[model samples]
Target: MDLHKPPAGPPAQPPVPASAQPPARTPEGCLVVAIRLPVRIVVLVLVLPVRMAWDALVVAGRFLGDAVLGPLGRALSWLAKALLLWPLIGLWRYVVVPVGKALGWLGHVLLVVPVVWSYRQVLTPLGYGLAWLARGAWAGLAWVYACVLTPAGHAVRWLLKGIGTVLAVVGAGAYTAVAWLVRFLIVVPARWIHAAVLVPTGRAVAWCARGVWRLLALLVTGIGVVLYWTVRILVVLPALALWRWVLAPVGRFLAVLAREVGEALGHAWRIAGRISSAVGRLLGTLFRWIFVEPVRWVYRTVLTPVGHAVRDAVLRPAARAARSVGRAARQALAAARETARQTRADLRRMLFGESLPREAVGRREPSAGETRTLGRSTTALTKD
Candidate 1:
């Protein structure tokens, strides 16, 4: 399968650009136009200096980051790797790894193996013995519960039931006697006192209380009526008039002024941004003409030519000489290596004589008779 092959489909068309898709614009009023112009003019005047200052700060920050901070950060990173990272890596790899492996092996042999052996040989059998003893104890408990405790529990329950019945009968007789005595001695006397003496006294007291309450209600009503009119004339009416005639109108006017000021500030800031951009471009052009252009011209016309001449006249010849020396050194080293290999081979042959050559065997195909079947064994144990 050829994975690099393109799909058999039509190429996609390019998307429409944002400039080609213009948005709808709403119409504005004369008031907005009048406000916008003056607001924008004032805002532009105010914001231009701030925008320029901000741009200057941004440029300075970028220059510092590129020219100073980037190189410093890279140098620090390299120093940290050399001083801290490399040594730690070497220690972990060479020292810690070997020691950890040795400790692990020792733990497995001296501690883990013995613990595992003890658990299997000693603890496992002990647990089984304990389990067997527990089973015997449980059976004894079950027998005792069934034979002795169950009957004893039944006898206790019956005895408690008989005692409870007798107590209930006695409690019922005592309750009836107490209820009879309370009704005659206490309840009858309280009922007579309430009917004969309390009833008339209560009725007289209630009549007096009603008359006092009526008198008090009339006085309170008269005072409340006077207070209502007095408060209405002195405080409530004046407050309402102030709110309607003065405060509400003032608040509405203030709100309108605030809205206009907010709108003016917004328009002014946008205009200021455009003005600042134009000023920045003008300054940048002037700077390029005054300083950058001359420097660029000098570098291109004079320095470039001088540098080319120096490279051709001095550096090229030196580089050629260095290359020649390097080539000669490499050739000499290669010749020395070849001589050493030849010397070692000659000495080995002198000491051990020439090695014997092996005979080459021809390849052959197996016959039908030599091919083993499922019923016949071809292994060494049953070979023919």
Candidate 2:
């Protein structure tokens, strides 16, 4: 039989008896159900003990934590008291009390001096000067007003105007006389005197200037020689002595200052070293008491118990659950791989004309054996 040959019979139809057709089965619907009702009940039973243990552990952890923290809180309270209370007491005793007493004494001493001294020395003289000036100015203004504004003042003003006119006429005559006298007597004689006096005065001034210049030059040369000798004897010798004296004092002061500063610095360094050592010891003690001991206690009392409880209860169960999930996932992956491999093999067999498994290709009724053979023959024609 040819595998590619078509069927010769007509198609037959099934009789319809159902009210409705059933839904088609999908690939997802073919999956096997692994978690059954019994497994779900077993999972619930296993989780119950873990939850109870976790709740008990949480209660125990809270109790242990409170117990550990209680001592630490009290210690912190004592530390705060030491840091704040002692310093406050010292400030009140040392600083505030002494400052108050000193201020009170200074205030009492200040009250002893005359309070009016400031006003008398600083303000009263200035006030008196101002009053005197104001009185004088007022009196002068009153006298001027009386002189210029009264009836007698008008007559006196007229008399003064007449006297002024007479004086002006006299002054004009005197000025003309003085002008003529100056031209005749002063100007002519002044010109003759100037001409007569200038030659001798010039010669005298030149002689005096030459004499003065020579004297100045001589004095300057004497001064220069004297200053040179004086500088060598007096200025230079004294300057050297003063330099030595100044340097001696300065060097002594500097040496003393250096020694004092060295001593001070050494003392400060010793103090600082002592303070540093004390601080280091204090910090070490604090660390041991505050951090190390408490941490050790917490680890032993609270954390250890809590860690053990969590490991036994929640962590162990969670780890087992994760492992079970991983195993299930691996099994599912393996089954899926097997299924994929089987499907690939079946598809290969179908497409490549290979025989499939008897289960995959269903069994059918036997029919007559019909075989056909194909042959090829050659016919030759010869020409003579």
Candidate 3:
């Protein structure tokens, strides 16, 4: 009965309070999210056309300004060039070139004029003076030749001829006198001197020879006695003493000297060895750095390429040429050898058609009796 009465009424539910609500979650410690590259790329793509259009507008405006001003700039530049070049060209043509040409002409004029004037004035005067002096000298010489030299020459000739005749006569007389005098004086005196001095000298020499022989005999006897004693006493004893006394000291000194020399040599050798070793090491290092390493590097880096180039461009051709030359030379040599062999055979045949017969050759030889005679003659010559 109650359910039938409430059937027309709606049911109601209870509400939750505000204090029972959960707290909101916050992203304070979370990593920042990044935008996708495609979105950024889309944005860039969207702005790129505008940027391109703006850039194109800016370039067009700059191009218009440049195009408008370009001829003006060129005109200003041309005016400046003209301003500089006109004055420079004018200066060169009017001042520098003309002045240079004038200076060259003036120098040539100065040189030529001075030289010509000097030649004409001073040198001509000096040459005229010299010519006048030479003419005067020639005239004076002619006068002297006519006046003094002619008479002097005649007188000198006369005197010379007279003197020559006199000298000849005197010389002949003197020669005769000298000959006679020399014969008389020299020959007579020489003969007398030879007779006198040689005869006396012969006697004296005979006496001196006897005395000298006696003296030499005494001297030889004394020398022999002295030599015997010296050999027995002085020489032998001194030599023995020298051997006994000096040899030990000499040997000792020599030993010490040899030892010192050996020690010095050893020291020098050691020092030299050390020096040589150090030098060798230094040189080896230097060579390695300067020559060996560089050469190796060049061989690797530079020489390899160069060698390859040479092989390609030069060496291969050279080798091929050499081979060809060698082949040609071999062929030439073969031809020459064949020709030589043929020529030698022809010469041999021309020289000798056939082998000589032994009997004919023997018959060409001398006969046995002739050979025996020749041998006997040779034996006689040998004996003589």
Candidate 4:
């Protein structure tokens, strides 16, 4: 054997002759072969209408997207560009750029150069001179304050202080003299008058007032006593006798009569109240027997049973039926979603000329346990 080549095994067997090979056999049973024609017929009949409708929808969708919507979108885009872009380009080129350049040139000439020149030549010198003047003026003012005005201000302040001290001393002494004179002339005299003349006059006047008050009190007392005896003799004794003899007996009789009447009236009021109470209770009993009790009977005997029957026989089953319908709709929607996902995968493969990438969908079929659980749930729903 060569170094690069592997060692050979036993020699290959010769090809089998065609006549010696057994023929392939068909696996179909008798029943399947017998029913095959009917199955094919039924399948074809079902598929024909679906195929026609699919072809029509595909053609219509393709025409709308490729012919109508494509041209309309392109034309609208072109019109939008024509409306929006051209005017902006023209304005920038013909108006805005030129105007901006002109304004820039004018500003450079009129504003920028003048400002630079004035700052360098005019404002610089003027500001320096004004600064110098301000410095000189400040120096002058400092000299006036420190060397000339300060000592003069001190001397003037000393003179003014001396004058203020003199005025204060004179004012204090004058105030003291005037105060002493006021005490002698006004306060002393007023005190003497109050102590000597006013006190004695007030005491004499108070004594005379007391005497007059006592005299008036005695006169009033004498008059009151005289009036009391006169009224008793002339009026009070006669009135008392008349009341004792005439008015007292009449008042007693009237009071007794009023008390009797009050007692009778009270007794009649209580009797009337009792009768009214009895009548009210009787009417209330009658009303209950006639109306409210019958209403309660109908509700308890008729309406309640009907409501229970309706709920048990009609509403509960109806609710279960609605729940079953909802469950069926959800199952159908899930099936449709899975079908749509498969269709999308097929479309992706067709459109992209690519092999299928995901084996997850193929592997995602429910397990046997899950299928049994689903069947059990479906059976339960049906039974319900």
Candidate 5:
């Protein structure tokens, strides 16, 4: 076998879909077809006007949204931004931001700087001095404990050990006497009563209880068997018989009726749509012919020439007269402005009198006749 070649026997077939497979045709009766035709006809008659009205309402709503609501919504949004949002944004940017920054700087200077300075200059040195004093006190305590308290504690411990030994011998004797008295007075009597009386009584009571429990259990089992049979005969059998003979058949018939009605409604709706569309097209064509065509003809043939004549005969001369008047007015305004300007100049000159002439200043660069070269220096260091 070659490694590169695929090992195959027969080519695989593609699976067929369940929907694409041929359906088993059932026989349809003549009565069903007759009934279906009248039902669909009635449904279509009822649905046609409704479909046309629905389509009209949809068109009207779309027109209203486009022509009225859309621009209104945009204007409202722009007005809100201009009246409310822009001022708030300006206040936040120009007023609030600067105030907040100043507050932050003030807080740092008033609170944080003092806290940091106190911690570094006052508290830190104080803590160190206190820590040094604590260390010295701790050293003195350690010295007292090692030199004075340790020896005193050893002496007390020795004294306590001797006293404890004497008490231990006395306590042992008293404990032995107490044990002897308790055994005879309490423990022996309790053991005897438990073994001799309680054991026999408990056994007799338990045996009687078991017998009563068994009798009750048998009685309960018999009652349960009778109730089970009674319920099966009275309730379960009748319910099962009713479901099998009456209810199931009624449910199947109703399901078949509902399915047929649904299919008929769908078929009627599609036919109604086509009828409504044709009616709408006819009405639209009639409207265009009756109204729009006449208006367009009048505009093209009669009104256009009349409008052009009016523009040429009356409007043109009026516009020319308006332009001439505007030009004359502008010239008069300019002459007035010149008169005012000259009057102001005369008044200023009369008040101040003639101005003094300014003096000439010398040039910083060398003059043409005094040009310096390599042979002659201009600096004081190499003056010639």
Candidate 6:
């Protein structure tokens, strides 16, 4: 039996089915389940209303969709057919067709006609003119380039190229000589001095820089701490004191005052509302009792009876008398008009020798003296 070697044993057995196994027991779980069962009942009780409402809502939706939707959809379809489709068909047939035709006519007349005219008359000729002008400009530009620009550019390029190269060479040589001389006189000495003196000086400066940096860091940290404490002492504590001593108390007092004022206002408002309600009720009662009811009573008890009596008694007699007066006046006026016509005719016959209408009555025509007397009477009546 080596330590590393496994001890061979029986093979592992498959687990038993839960139905075949004995039930596991946990007292704590039973206790927890007992506690949680009541909690679940409470939760169910709490959620019962919301769940019922949700189910009711679902039922209502189903009812609306299953029962009401068909009629509503049919109504909407009928409206669409009657109001939308019919009117749209009519508009397309009558109005839209004519408008489209008019717009097409306008487009042809205003846009197409102008475009065609411009293309033929203005744009075509202008294009030819521009082409000719462009040709002339091209020729001129070619001539100027050939005569002036090309020669000038060549001459300038050659001069610049030659002079720049010579100047650059001389300047480069001078710069190289000056560079070496400066290096010999200054840079070499400076490098030697840097290796000998500057290295130590730089180390001293670096050490000083580190000391200064450490001091600055300490100072900054100390300043931050001091600032923090100062703020706590100067600003924070004072703010806390103000809040505790003054602001909080003031806020509480203001809240109490506002509540009192609101309560007073509410009380006053209720009183005023009651008073106004009473006044309105009194006024309504008075109006109904003194005006509406009394007027209705008077109309019913006195006015209607009086009106009927007057219609039967006074108005009937008056209407008959008016009719009699009107007939008598019409007959008198007609008779007077006939008499005037005869009299006027007689007067005309006397003055202008015109025969009187019904010239002789019973062979006793009116005499001249009678005619003259009739004329005078007629003139007086006309004057009157």
lDDT of 3 by residue, 1-384 (tens): 455654566667567677877876555322112223333445454545555455557767888779977878899889988999888989999999989999999998989889999999899899989999999999989988899878878878888898788789878887897898789878988898888778987898899789989988998999999889878896788888898899977886676555545545445455555555565578669989988888898789998898899899998999999999999999999999999999998999898896666664535444666564544543444543
Scanning candidate 1 in windows of ten residues, the lowest lDDT window is 360-369
Name the better of 1 and 5 by TM-score.
5
Query: 166-239, model 2: which lDDT tens digit per residue?
Result: 99999999999999998998899988888898878898889989998999999999999988998899778888
- Please, what are the lDDT tens digits per residue for candidate 4 over residues 238-304? 9999999989988876665555455444554455456555665787799999998999999999999
Candidate 4 lDDT = 0.82
lDDT of 1 by residue, 219-290 (tens): 999999999999999999999999999999889767655666787777766766677788879999999999
**TM agreement with the true structure for every prediction:** 0.61, 0.32, 0.28, 0.28, 0.73, 0.39
- What is the C-alpha local distance difference test score of candidate 1? 0.89
- Tens digit per residue, CA lDDT, model 5, 266-354: 88788778887898899899999999999999999999999999999989999999999999999999999999999988998899986
Query: Under the 3 Å rule for N, CA and C atoms, how many clashes does model 5 have?
Result: 0
* Candidate 6 weakest ten by summed lDDT: 375-384
Candidate 4 — which residues are off by over 4 angstroms? 1-226, 238-277, 308-317, 341-384
Which runs of model 3 end up more than 4 angstroms from their true locations?
A: 1-124, 143-148, 155-193, 196-198, 224-228, 231-384
Looking at model 2, report the run of 10 residues with the lowest lDDT sum. 375-384
Badly placed stretches (over 4 Å) of model 2 are 1-225, 244-247, 355-384
lDDT of 6: 0.82
- In Å, residue 257's CA in model 5 sits off its true spot by 2.9
Whole-model alpha-carbon lDDT for candidate 5: 0.91
Question: Which candidate wins on lDDT?
Answer: 5
Model 3 quality (TM-score): 0.28
